[model samples]
Target: MDKFTTLTAVAAPLPMINVDTDMIIPKQFLKTVERTGLAKGLFFELRETPDGKPVPDFFMNQPQYKGAQILVAGDNFGCGSSREHAPWALLDYGIRCVISTSYADIFYNNCFQNGILPITLPKAEVDKLMDAAKRGHNARISVDLEKQEVTGPDGGVIKFEIDAHKKHCLLNGLDNIGLTLEKKSKIDSFESKQHGTQPWLYAQAGR
Candidate 1:
């Protein structure tokens, strides 16, 4: 995981509601656990035809939206079965932040775990950003995690709320493993004490 303090980049507009995890990376691409190559499958169905031809009209396929790091999406984004790969694919594709009116609970948490910021704003505010996103690379959306604010291209600022603990974890680049490591000394001490008290627990297998 990477620290997410602030980000300013072109935002790709995805105005469709009810975007599920399958639509994001597709089932065919979920076999592997590696996150790097999943970008090729991000929105695979939307970006390519059944015959494997590119969909030139899709926002992601358009030249202006290439390398977009922010996504302004419609309501109920990432709705469907819980899949950690959804956020992995988005992060692999360079999407550091996602702004939507609503999101599925599992996907929202997955974003934070994967170092992606999933923002939930009112419909009016999201709509405003969506309009700005239509301006292509010219309109850059800025997200400041510390301030919990998102500034649109028109200089409009919208404030959002997030859990304080999650904010701290993201700011410090602490995933579950990283968090556990923070208490290494305590864990080591506890193990040493336990070993002294419960010698049989550490006895050799043959014994």
Candidate 2:
């Protein structure tokens, strides 16, 4: 996981509701556990035609939105199955943040674990950002986690609320594994004490 303190980058507008996990990476691409190459399969059906050619009209396929690090999406984003791969694909495609009016609970949790910031804002605010994102190369959205604020291209700022724990995790780049590692010394000490207290249990393990 990477620290997500602040970001100022191009935001691609995806104004479709109920964008599910399958629609994100597709079932065919779910066979691999590796995260790197999943970007090729990100929004595969929406991005490609029957013959596997790129869809010219798709937001992601457009040249101006290439390398976009933010996504301003519609409501119910990341719905359906609780697949961690959805966030993996999004992160691999360089989407560090997703701003929507709402999101599925499972997918929202998965985003934080994978270092993707899933933001929930009111419909009016999201609509404004979506419009800013539509301005092509000129509009770059800025997100600051510490301040819990999003600055649109036109210099308008919108404040958002997030759980303090989640904010801390993102600021420190702490995933579940990273959080556990932070207590390694305590874990080691506990294990050492347990070993001394239960010699017979340790001996049975040796068998």
Candidate 3:
């Protein structure tokens, strides 16, 4: 996972509510575990037509938002199945942050794990960001995790609250495995002590 300290980039406005995992990457694109190729499948149905042509009206399909690094979305974003692929797709598509009025619990948690910042702000604040996003590439948004603040195009700032532990992990680029690795020396010492205390246990495992 990458460190998410601060990000300043174009934000794509996705005003639709109740966006689920299937709508994000679709079931057809779920077979592959690799994250890189999933960007093409992000919002696959909304981005493509029946013939697989890009939809001109879709926010992400539009030229201005094609490289958006942040998303200002409606309420209940990332609802439905608890698929880790959803965040993977979003991250792979260059969305470092998602600002919404609300988000599903599992998806919100998944975002933090995947180095994506899922921000929950009041409706009024989100609406402001959405409006800013509508201005296209000119309206770049700034997300500063250390300060827990999001600054919109017009220089208005919105403060958000986040779990301290999750904040710490993201700042240091520490996932679950990375967190465990932080105690490598301790773990190695404990294993050495256990090996000496229970030589029979190690011998039994050798069989």
Please state every model's RMSD to the true fold in angstroms: 1.6, 1.3, 1.3
lDDT of 1 by residue, 1-207 (tens): 899999999999998999999999899888998889889989999999999999987888899998899999999999998989999999999999999999999999999899999999999999999989989988799999999999888888899999999999999998888899999999999878978898687687432
Clashing residue pairs in candidate 3 are: none
Candidate 3 or 2, higher lDDT: 2
Cα lDDT over the full model 3 = 0.92
Per-residue lDDT for 140 in model 1? 97
Compute the lDDT of residue 128 as modeled in candidate 2: 94
| Candidate 3 per-residue lDDT over residues 9-114, each given as its tens digit | 9999998999999899799988987878898889999989999898888897789887899999999999999999999999999999999999999999999989
Candidate ordering by lDDT (highest first)? 2, 1, 3
- Residue pairs with clashing backbones, model 2: none
Query: Scored by CA lDDT, what does every candidate get?
Result: 0.92, 0.94, 0.92
Off by over 4 Å in 1: 204-207
The local lDDT score (0 to 100) that residue 198 gets in candidate 3 is 78
Write the residue-wise lDDT of candidate 2 on 133-187 in tens digits.
Answer: 8888977999999999999999999999999999999999999999999999999
TM-scores of all predicted structures: 0.96, 0.97, 0.96
